[model samples]
Target: MRILHIIHSIDPRSGGPSHALRGLVQEQVRRGHQVSILTTNAQSAEPWMPDDQFRERMNNDPAFSGAELFIARGYGRTRPVARFTWTPQAYRWLRRRLADLDARPDIVHIHGVFSHLTTFAPRLARRFGVPYIMRPAGTFAPRCMALGRTAMKRWFTTLFVAKDLRLAAAVQATTPAEKDELREQFGLNNVVVIPHGVAGVKDAQTDAPAARRALNIPERAKVLLYLSRLTPKKRPDWVIQAASKLLSEYPDLFTIFAGPDAGAESQLAAAIASSGLNGQVKRFGFVTGDQKRQLFEAADVLVLPSQSENFGVVVVEAMAHRLPVVVTPGVASHIYVDASGCGLTVEDSVDALTDGIKKILQADKTELGQRGREYVRQHLTWIVVSEKISEVYAAIIRNQRTRRRNRSVNQQIRLTTK
Candidate 1:
């Protein structure tokens, strides 16, 4: 099958959606399907482009070798002065390009919503009578709209997104929580639950001591890592507070908050200093690629106290590394962790987070980490996810063919009756 993915941006720091796209494309390519990506050339002031380590991995990683990227200029910013990812020129170019393709895509997979692509891509698919799937990437959840943008969202949905979503062959959500949110908001029953997949990292399997040496993490210190975007929604401050609470008991505990600071680093630093958790809490803004793998290996445990996470990609990444996780109520994977005994799920509070951390530390950590690793290997790898996604694509195409066949038969019957 020939598949084309349309996303606002491919920058990894754009968050889970971008990474999820990479995983899906890699798996699809490995499965012998032709896959290509159409993405915006949006560059945020912050770093998201692959660093030296990531470039090296991409060069050697066979999964990434076949996935091709076509970058076009885009405009419009989610934040003031950020990269323009939804430009008019890009939208026009895409429409023209799709029209001109010699071999039209079997399926057009659109990722992210409330962007120019979201508004335009689906219309093009409908115009060409091509089946397309829309993955909102958790944008429809209530928490995502609660930041004083409800009115604009409602207006946008009514005018543009609603028609596209209703006309879509399928709508995909990465978690059950997201599926529910979409159903409630859109009253649509077509939502399918499909979680994002993680590519296995061999560096994650490296010995902890060696990994620590590589990352310059002291072997004696029990590292608690917070790996995600430094955004207000992620509640990075909560991790700092939780670490403060555990400092008395585990004096050697060192917590590092790493990831691209999406305008939240200053506040996080302020909180760390005010709590006098300066030494214990360090903000290593934006680590990715091999640096990300080494950090995962060096860490004893991972914490993501998010206010709302449709699906926590970093959680599974940590799990894949054989590291236990501490996720808050907002994370959709809380239920999985609770059921698998891989980690603890706590409320989105400092006290609860602190207790959850303590519990994981006291338990058989090695066993817990192993359970996490096994869980990811069995259920969350790209190979497994891609297989399911392929089924979705095949079903959509088959249904389309059936509908067309029925129409043709009906026309023939009418001619005979006449």
Candidate 2:
């Protein structure tokens, strides 16, 4: 099937939604489907998501990067983030591109269109008379609003944006929690819960000692890595508090917070200082590409303390690296962690996270890592996700065919009666 993915930025550090799109595109192309991405990233003098290695790899990949790169202009001159979530160029580009394309797509799958790329794309897809699927990627959920800490943006979304999502043929959720969040809190009228997942790396094992040395990690210290954007939603404070508690009990524990500071960097930095963990906490500002993989390799466990996560994609990535994960209980990834025993699940608290890290330290790291890999292999591979997506696309096409047939039969009956 010919599929066009509408995304805000092709930049990888922009996070999971972008990563998921590129991965699926690669797989689809391998399966002999023509996959194209329409985005609104103009020629920036400086790298917009400079810290993202995944974005770098995707940009350089022989298969993925060779695809068309549509750069559009938008309203994000003043702030770094405004460029991503408020770019107005995305919708306009999608509308014009649809008209200009030589062959119409079987489906136009939209990802993260509500931010940076602008909000106009979904409405344009509706106008083109093509069935477009919106993957809010957990942006429209109640949890997202709380995480974002912006009541006004939440209100605007409820009034103007969510209706656009409802207008789409269907919305995609990465997990069951997200699906429920969409229906219950977001009042989503049409939705499908297809796991936005990752495949375990082939021979993903690494030279742990080398990775440690590159990161300057001490051999005696147990590495605790939190790799994601430094944001309030990520609840980095929980990790900091946990670190303070572990300092006395586990003196050799090294707490590393590595990722771009999207909005909450200063706040997290402040917390780290106030906690008086001057020597213990290591802030790597941001990591991408190979640096990211190496950090994962050096770590004993990955910690995601998100108060609200649709599906923590990094949980699977950590598993791929054969690292155990410690995640918040309410997240969609928690379901995977709890069921698979690949990692420990903790409640939303300082002591809870602290205990989780302590418990993880007790377990056999090798066994935990193996379990994590097994979990991803069973529940979250690209092949499994592709099959699910193909089923949804086929279902929509079949439904359209039935509706056309019914309309034709009614016309024939009217002619015969006349």
Best of the candidates, TM-score: 1
lDDT of 2: 0.75
Please state the error at residue 304 of candidate 2 in Å. Answer: 1.5
Which regions of candidate 1 deviate over 4 angstroms?
44-64, 77-84, 201-205, 416-418
lDDT of 1 by residue, 16-127 (tens): 8888888888778878998877766664436545444444444454545697666666655456323325567767766776787686788899998877766788998888
Q: Please give the lDDT score at residue 161 for candidate 2.
A: 75
Clashing pairs in 2: 53-288, 53-289, 84-116, 85-115, 85-116, 86-116, 91-121
Instruction: Count clashing residue pairs per candidate.
Output: 2, 7
Q: Count clashing residue pairs in model 1.
A: 2
List ranges where model 2 is wrong by over 4 Å. Answer: 42-63, 79-92, 113-118, 147-151, 186-189, 274-278, 412-418
lDDT for model 1 = 0.80
lDDT of 2 by residue, 163-191 (tens): 87778788888887778777886677688
